[model samples]
Target: MMDRRERKRPAAQPGSRRRTAALLLGSAVLLAAALSARPVPHEVVVQFGDDVSAREAANALASLGATVLWVNRSEGVWAVRMPDPGEAWRLYDRGAERVTDAKSYSST
Candidate 1:
């Protein structure tokens, strides 16, 4: 006689095939939704210094419609607010950092 374990039937049956297909379709739909759903942040800038050079850079960035957070004369570098992690690189030349956090942003 065959061992009980060896005589066991296959896990999948023709009747359950439809259920398996439905489950696979459901998972695909969910994955697609998750991949497509994401938020895009708005960008702004906070310039530091009012000197000719600083003002020039500020004016250039102004056309982009970035909000000015602050202008500090004490520091010569400009502070631009990035809408997202991707745009943060735009401020590398002048120096960029997360306003809320201490993360540093620089090209080098």
Candidate 2:
């Protein structure tokens, strides 16, 4: 009885609100999962001066009950995993110039 141009269209055509709510709920779940995730206690990279050798650096870390995961002989840097983070100071006393966390750049 009314002209098509004068009649108003349905606000959302139906089911659009449900789809939008599902999308929002999925996004919230993903956000919560990401926020709860944590990184492992990755090893530390010990940097020594040029005067230090790879073997010497390894030995220094070994004395602290740490394990040498890898050795970069050319750069005089060793990736070592200590029992605790507090051992970084002892590394300085043992002749280490710098100690930094060895973090992963890529995610699996």
Candidate 3:
């Protein structure tokens, strides 16, 4: 006679297959949602030296293909969306007194 341990296992319940299919569908939906999300744009706050004119700063940023969102002439700051990380360094090399991430800020 066959041992109890060697006997074949019972078939899965009818509802289990539906549950598995639903789980798989949910997972696929989640994956699609994640894949469809776009990456956040890179933004920077560039401060120019006192001697740099607003026109000069605007020209420089335009030459780098940056999208100027805002300009604070009194503070000599420009909020710009750069295409990539390397552009921040390029801004510095181009005459930015300081280059910092746009998200870096203090509420107070």
Best by TM-score: 3
> Against the hidden true structure, what lDDT does model 1 obtain?
0.51
Given candidate 2, what's the lDDT at residue 38?
A: 46
TM-score of each: 0.33, 0.52, 0.58
Q: For residues 1-108, could you state the per-residue lDDT of candidate 1 as single tens digits?
A: 898888967687667988988999999999999877754444343333344366566664464444555555644444444435354445534433322211352323
Worst 10 residues of 3 by lDDT: 99-108
lDDT of 3 by residue, 1-108 (tens): 999999999999989999999999999999999976754467888888888888888888888788999887474789999876576787776678888888993323
lDDT of 1 at 94: 47
| lDDT at residue 51 of model 3 (Cα atoms) | 82
Pick out the ten consecutive residues of candidate 2 with the lowest summed lDDT.
Answer: 99-108
List the candidate numbers ranked by lDDT, top first: 3, 2, 1
Clashing pairs in 2: none
- Error of model 1, residue 13, in angstroms: 4.6
Consecutive 10-residue window with the lowest summed lDDT within model 1: 98-107
Q: What is the C-alpha lDDT of each candidate?
A: 0.51, 0.75, 0.82
Q: How many residue pairs clash in each candidate?
A: 0, 0, 0
